[model samples]
Target: MWIRALQAVLDRGIRQGRLHVRFPDGRMGSYGPGAGTGPEAQLMITDPALPRRILLNPQMALGEGYMDGGLSFPSDDDLRGFLQIAARSAQSGRLPLPMRLAHGLRVRTKGLMQWNTLHLARRRVQHHYDIPDAFYALFMEEDLQYTCAYFRDDAMTLEAAQAAKMAHIAAKLCLRPGLRVLDIGCGWGGLALYLARAHGVHVTGITLSQVQLEAARSRAAAMGLSDRVAFRLQDYRHVPDRFDRVVSVGMMEHVGVPQYQAYFDKIHGVLAEDGVGLIHFIGRHTPPRVLSPWFQKYIFPGGYAPAFSEVIPRVERAGLVVADLEVWRGHYERTLRHWQQRFRANEPRVRDMFDDRFVRMWWYYLIAAEVSFTDMGMVLFQMQIARRSDAVPRVREYLYPAPGDDQRPSDTA
Candidate 1:
């Protein structure tokens, strides 16, 4: 029955023009069973070895299979998208049994997983952020903002969404002229330069990657905002001065479970009296017993998304009041899709630096991420936090159009 169901879906995908199997000679055909019989299909079809290769060495095999002229796709992105959908559905009920057992054992001996150690954390940070600046620049916008973007409307381009994100974050922080703003894990200094150049705020950005720090500094100098915005190659724990506002975007995932409290404490310690801190993060609906093995091994090694229950307690413990919480779930799906599109458009430039496997791996990661957001209804949260004694303000509110708004489209300039 399950096999029949799978075949039916595959047929539907091909019929709908969503999946097209490609032959070695570069001719595309429908993905039906008999479509593999033609002479053109000799490269990829009728060989048990092909499927075995793909399944056993998932990342490397798939990459080599595509590159060695053994397999092809009408659109690599769409092929992976459909494959992810099918895999997730097939594994929905049955695969979680072993996952549950593994999670239970990990939870039983929590400390046995050395993910929280400083060495491991540093290694994880380096593994993801240490990718060449030029490689990231291939797809990321000129500003090089690496987090989820806030779109004022669906018609808004990625550039506009990124600008909106910076403006929104700055407004939330209420940056005034000459006030010091601290950006934790600042990527490429987009927000820092935005705050300094647009809002006349003095910004200090910290990052673990030397590549990011140098790129940010050069960008700041080019923009003539070097004096107002500074990028430091340092960790958040070692930041020396207090600031009027603190903003950490997409950095919380790296803060392991055991270090959550300490992370918050350090942020709280550096924030001035009545200061505001805006934390933007991708959150999970429920706490996972363990990080996904694939993500831990391939993508972000020490990263874990936190549930609201886990986050709120830490904020309260750090003596901060959450004055406002805004959830932007669908916006992230659009943001990631935009990124995937940009990456695809620049594939030639990217392939020059990285191999086919790395490219496929990243594409799979992004598409799978998009599917996860759609399936689980996960959220992106931007919380306005302040010292406990600071009174919450009822400022005049401004609401933007929702995800489907037609006014904004295309993230390009």
Candidate 2:
């Protein structure tokens, strides 16, 4: 019964790519279109119980099966290639009636899943970000910008693109000498130090992760900007001072549906009358839905990539004007591809640090994120907001000046 149920899922879910499967009973099966120019992968199942597990919860079981060595790819097509096919197929196919009901139920109960109390928030941040700095250095650039890097062009290196990202945000913030800025959810103080050094502004960065707070403080001290920049182990709700500019990158996803109002309210309260703010976050184009069970259980505990419909109303309630919004469609895909390549290249080092299971988990996490952007209607939103209508320039000429007219740092500061 389980075999037939699993086969039914595979047959319906994989219409575009060809998937060759070897069952535990020594039976060979094939799924997807017989004739197609698409990703072709071979899945070998070693554990007999995996089929029942997959049928019970396909999204969670497949990833767990791969990590536990119960399932593996026999062909050169690795997990990334297979996930690309899976993501595309899921995007094109309609969800079954049961799955649709489950989705609706999840949407209603999303707040419960993402309670994000102050204590729980800290614990959750530590779960994902408290890993050793050396582990991140394996795949990240010199500055350790863990968020999405901007891909200006196809040829831009990760380092260059990260610098460009800071420059872009700096321009949107309307920076000037002596302006006070707040960096909420600052990963490692890269952007804070950049703003202080390049734009001559004072920055106060707040975060919940102890590992990140220490790393950020160390980086600021090393750069001789400790006086200009400070890193605090505090949540956004506790921040006291107002700022001329406020920027949060890749942080809003963790703010959760329940905390959207409080999150924006904190921003609005901390932002001065003439302040300009920018929030860069991953958001979906579709309506609000529950996150994957695998993702919630493994990668990020309290994270939710909100839909714009769920986000905009909160901003309005906070009395902040959405001055400008830009959708970054393929930028994250390129960024993840770079990280994936670098990670696989350093697989030996990663294994030395952890183990094969850890490596596979991280690989799956990165690839699943990449394809989420490519096929699942996920996008990066760079939203420039303000308390007043005229806080920024009337036109967006400041964001993208005429080539050399822009004085913002395009390279590492």
Candidate 3:
């Protein structure tokens, strides 16, 4: 009975990709079109409870099972391929009625997972970003940019792409010499340093992660830009100054939906009357009213990727005029692909840092994130806002620096 019921769930959830499942009792099953014919995923169910767990809730159980050794794939590469296919098929799919109600109950009881209180917010940021810098360096650029990078040129290397991302945001800000800029949720101060050194602005960066704050401060001191750039261990809500520019990259996801208006209101209050601000975040193509259970439990404690529909109204209410909006599609897929490659190459070090289970979980997180960007209608949105009507130029050409107007780091190692 479990086999037939589980088979039905698999067929509905993975409609197009082929997943060949070998049951614990030596029974075999194939699901989806072209099943067992050049299948992308082959699963070995070692525990009898795996199917029941999946039936109760498949979206997250699969990852949990993999982490706990209840499920196995032939290889890590195949595992990623399988997850990509599964996530793609599950994008427009639905879980069983019982499963939906169970998940809903779990979400309601765990409301603490999505609230970013001042004290708790620091802990939450540390939960994800407090890892040693070396771990991130394994997959990220030398700058240690821990956010989505803009890859304007497909052939560009990750380092160059990251540098270009800084330049892109800098140009969009319409910066000038001696202007003051505020960086909310600044990870490692790469963007802040770039703005200060390249654009001649005094950059003040704030973050809740102590590890990130130290690294950023050290980097600024080493680069002799400490005089122009500074990093503080503080929350955005506590900031008590105004600036000519405000920029936040990959930070709003942690703010939660309830704080949307407060976030915009604070940004509006902080900006000078003629200040220009830009916000870059992960947005959904279709609004999922609820956050994912697995993501809330395992990856981001309070992260909720909001849709523009949920974001635009708050900006209007805060009296911030939308200057421009850019939707970045498929670029993050390529970025995650690069990160996955680097992470794969550094497995020996990762294994040394933790165990096989931890390594597997990390790989699954990276793979699932890549799948989200590629197939789940997930994209990056950069919204430029201003206080005064004429704060920014009317034309968009100012955002594109001339051939030699800006300098980027070398792509080659």
Candidate 4:
């Protein structure tokens, strides 16, 4: 029955022109006969142990299997994409009783504080982003923006979409040429440098990762933006300087529900009276006491996405007016798919740095995120906010620039 089910999946891929199978060992067999050629061409998994290892002990076994010559792929990255697509489809079907029971167990035991707080958060961040910078460099475009790209139209590429996201956020903030802008949890300094170099805005970017901080600072220096854009190795809670504008992209997931109000208050305290702030974050459909056990254990620790029900009240208590709230649920699905493709395309390099299980874990993470957005309709929100008493119009709408137009010059502070 399992063979039949697996074959059905392979057949779908074959019919779609997404897969082709061949045997390189010259062994005649009834199953999947004449799939492909060459030592690396065959889809050679006859033993049940390999598949069982992948399924039962997924966190560690997959990586060990890959390293110990248990599996081979023409492209590891491509394999990641293929498995992601397949797993998502498979997950859509009704899960068996055992699987449901297992899920329930996970939910019941979720969110116990385990590792020392600092070490736990650090490990979680490292597991996902600590892949060698070069590995990320292969997939991310020149700017290395590691967040959701905002697509202006269906035709825009991921890199172009990302650039658009940066431009969009910058424009909404109305950054001035000499105004100080703070980027909380700046990833790779893409947006910070964009504001500093392109718009002549002085920017300060804060991050917890020492590696990220160094890379961002170096990039700023290389672009001769050292004087205008600065990268700091500090936590957002510790940042004391006031700025004309503040922007945080894809970072709120790290701030759990208990800390949401404190996070907002910090932003409120750090903003100049006339300052505006933009928060771009992944949002959840329902409120959960904590994140999923599987995600918390294997993926992001101390990470929880809150719904608008939780966010709106917190923001109101912080004395901020919501200028705008835009949700892009579909774009994130497309974005995750793009990342999966790039990760698959560059698997050889990835394998060199991390073990097979690590690869599969990431594969699952990316694909599952894609599936969540598609199946559950998860949302990505960009909120524009300002001090509640500010005289700015409550319903102001600004036009985003067309792709080919010259980037608007920054306002003079």
Best by TM-score: 2
Candidate models: Cα lDDT each: 0.69, 0.87, 0.83, 0.68
The residue ranges of model 3 lying beyond 4 angstroms of the native Cα positions read 35-39, 91-94, 102-113, 401-413
Query: Which digits, one per residue and each the tens of the lDDT, describe model 3 over residues 1-413?
Result: 77679888777766666778898778888777765433377889888888888887776788898888888999866786677677666554465678657766855654456666888788888888999888888888899987888888789898888887887888778888888999999999999998888878899999999999999999999999999998999989989999999999999988887778889999999999999999999988876545667777788888877778989999999999999999998788888988998999998998898789988888888988887776667889999999987888787766664696632211110
In candidate 2, stretches whose alpha carbon ends up further than 4 angstroms from where it belongs are: 75-78, 92-97, 407-413
lDDT of 1 by residue, 1-413 (tens): 32233234445433211334433333434443333321111123222345455433333444455444455544555555454443443334432244346546755554344346666766778899888888877777778888899887889998899888987886677666777889988888888888788778899999887778888999999999988998998778788899988999998878776787888888789988878889999886646544444666677777767678878888889888888898887888898889888998988777788877787677767776776677554678888898854433454242232566522211111
Candidate 2 C-alpha lDDT tens digits along 110-132: 78989999999999999899999
The model with the greatest lDDT is 2
What are the models' TM-scores?
0.78, 0.95, 0.92, 0.74
Positional deviation of residue 25's Cα in model 4 after best superposition, in angstroms: 23
Task: Report the error of model 2 at residue 362, Å.
Answer: 0.3
Q: RMSDs, each prediction?
A: 7.3, 2.2, 3.6, 6.6
lDDT of 4 by residue, 108-165 (tens): 5543432224455556666666656776786677788888889879999998999889
Backbone clashes in model 4, listed as residue pairs:
21-35, 21-36, 22-35, 22-36, 63-356, 63-357, 77-344
Clashes of each: 8, 0, 0, 7
Instruction: Quote the positional error of residue 392 for candidate 3 in Å.
Output: 0.8
Better of 2 and 3 by lDDT: 2
